[model samples]
Target chain A: MNPTTLKLCLMAVLSLVGIGLYGLMICRNLIKMVIVLQILVKAAALGLILAGQMSSQINLGQSLGITVIVADTIVAVVGMALAVQVQRRLGTLDVDALSSLRG
Target chain B: MLEAILFALPILTALLAGIQAIRTRSLIRSALWLAGVSASIAVLFYMLGAHQVAVIELSVGAGLVTVLFVFAIGIAGAEIQPQRPIVPKTLAWVLILVAILLLAGFALPFATTVQHSTEPETTSVFWQQRGLDVIVQVVLIFCGVLGLLGVLAEEKAPLDQPMVDEIAAERERDLRNLEYQSSQSMVSSQQGQTR
Candidate 1:
């Protein structure tokens, strides 16, 4: 990739990270939180690939991206499972309602 | 022009999808929009010459994650009752804009300084060089599976005897109340018939 392309890609990654953080700050729903997390991780993975491309170690970048994908999948699965349990027990998915730790 | 178009298309799609994912009211729609974001990212990855990562992102990030989100929504609930955001919208936007600008300021100079390589190495580095990371990732995946099982497991009653006894007693009282109500209704019907 050219320097200009790299700059553009980096900008996109930053924009994505910003959007994800914004969503995390405002969204109260647990599942929505997970969705935002997924977005954030995707941008990170893109950044990893970009780093690899820049460093002339595209293979290393791709490998790291794959590792990130596997870990992210596990996170989503576990997050969803926990969200289901929270909804079942607390009767609401709002993170604010979870302020009281009482079962 | 074509190269510019290729980069612009995916980036625009990703930005728009991400914004919609956060803004949409329906949880399912939000998840779908997230999938859209993932797909666009995959496109960007492919354009960046990371074809393998792009495929995985399409399959896992766009496909599996979206399915998981939808399934979770199906179980938990689909509609999020509209509520005020935790942070006020104006303040949140200002903070986000400031953060993005700060990050870009820090990142842009470093990005410009890096010279692109003519010869790019591919998957050999992954298989030959990063064995430790692969093993650790495997271990992490196993732990995640175990954690999922633990979270989803049926809750056993508390070990405390008093608490168990109290729950049993409460259930019994509820059953008795239900029986009494049914009997009282039956008695009232009998009296009306007699009249």
Candidate 2:
């Protein structure tokens, strides 16, 4: 990859991270939070690959990216499971309503 | 020129999809948009020469994750009544602006310094050197399955007789009190009619 391409990929990764963080800050829905988290992980995976491309260790980056994907999938699955439970028990998906877990 | 455009296409698509995923009101729609973002990212990965990771991203990120989100939406109800963001809009925008500036500052230095390597053998690196990551990922997947089972498990009624009896008694008492109150109100109304 040329430096220009590398730079563009880096910018995309940064933008994705920013968007993910902004979403995390603003979104109160538990499911939305999970979605934002997935986005953040995607950015990280892309960044890892970009780093690999930069250093010429593309295989290492790909391997790490695969690791990230597996971990991220698990996170998403567990997060959704927790969200379903929260909705069932609390009768609402709003994170604001979960302020006191006293039930 | 052709290479840059090819890279730009997927990057643009990913960014747009990501923004739409955040901006969309419906959870399902947001999930779909996320799928688009993931697909585009996979494309980007393929373009970047990470063929295996790209395939996995397409399957796991775009396919499996989106399916999970839809299933979750089906069970949990799709739309929450829209609420104002926890962060005020002005502050949120300011924060985003600051974040962008910081990211540009951090990322700009690396743009000119990237050096490309000739050998791109992903298979050996994945299988030989990164064995720990693969093992840990397997463990993580198992733990995730266990966690899902734990979270979604049906809550069994307590076997404690005393606690069960106490709860039953409390419910019965509340029912009796409600009945008594209704009866008292009826008698008062009848008495008022006689007057």
Candidate 3:
């Protein structure tokens, strides 16, 4: 595919992911929102990879993107586990209601 | 154009996944849709001739991340009422306008170039000469997963017990309240029997 075409498609993916990210922010639940946020990050990573490919040396972009995926997976899993723990202990996942530091 | 056409199936599937994900009420369904999206996009990467990236997105993006989302949804349960998405409504118009403009102004020219006799030579830059950086990415993914396994092992000990206590307490209160009312009526009925 031509570079311009790739860029356009990549932009579409970015816009979609951005929409999801906005949704993630608006939701009250932590776990589902985090998962949604990850989707946004993944979309960004894909765009970066495709843009990199368009310029040449596709492997470099591919490898860096993979690195990101791996790290992101770890972060996501840890975050999910912590969220689960909090939900189990607190009996709720709504962040607004769970604020103990509020005076 | 031909290459893009070749990927039409997976592209549509991926788009469907995104649409489903954005609209689904259940967290589990949304997570599943993300999985579908990842898989379709992975296929798209393959069509774009990025075999290695496709492999990574398939295993890590499609496989590992989806697993994480599913597990998250599992722990959270399917008891939510998602709100309507206003951002999407605004985005829809913006995206449509941008697409129309890009196609009319830029994409049409690119599309015509699809039939150009000679394809431009792609970058022989850093990718073709990857050196040792590939090892770094593999190690990063492995290390992340390994660390997660350890954390999960430790976290499992207290997994969700605290929240269960709250739910249990609420249930106990409700049950006691019901029992108290039942006894009052029972006593009244017994007095009637005696009379």
B1-195 in candidate 2: lDDT tens per residue? 778888999999999999999999899999999999999999999998888999999999999899989988888889867888989878987898898889779767876776755764677788788989889998999988986784566643245567889989999999999999999999999999999
**Could you give the candidate ranking by lDDT, starting with the highest?**
2, 1, 3
lDDT of 2 by residue, A1-98 (tens): 67788888888998898899899888999999999999999999999998787777888999999999999999988888888878876788889878
Candidate 1, residue B64: the lDDT equals 79
Clashes of 2: 0
Ordered from best to worst DockQ, the candidate numbers read 2, 1, 3
Clashing pairs in 3: A56-B123, A88-B163, A89-B162, A89-B163
For residues B75-118, what per-residue lDDT tens digits would candidate 3 score against the true structure? 65666655544346666556646654663464234332332233
Q: For residues B129-182, write the lDDT of model 1, one tens digit per residue.
A: 877778978987897787567456565424557888888999999999999999
For candidate 2, list the clashing residue pairs, or say none: none
Considering DockQ, which of the candidate structures 1 and 2 is the better prediction for this target? Answer: 2
Looking at model 2 chain B, report the run of 10 residues with the lowest lDDT sum: B150-159
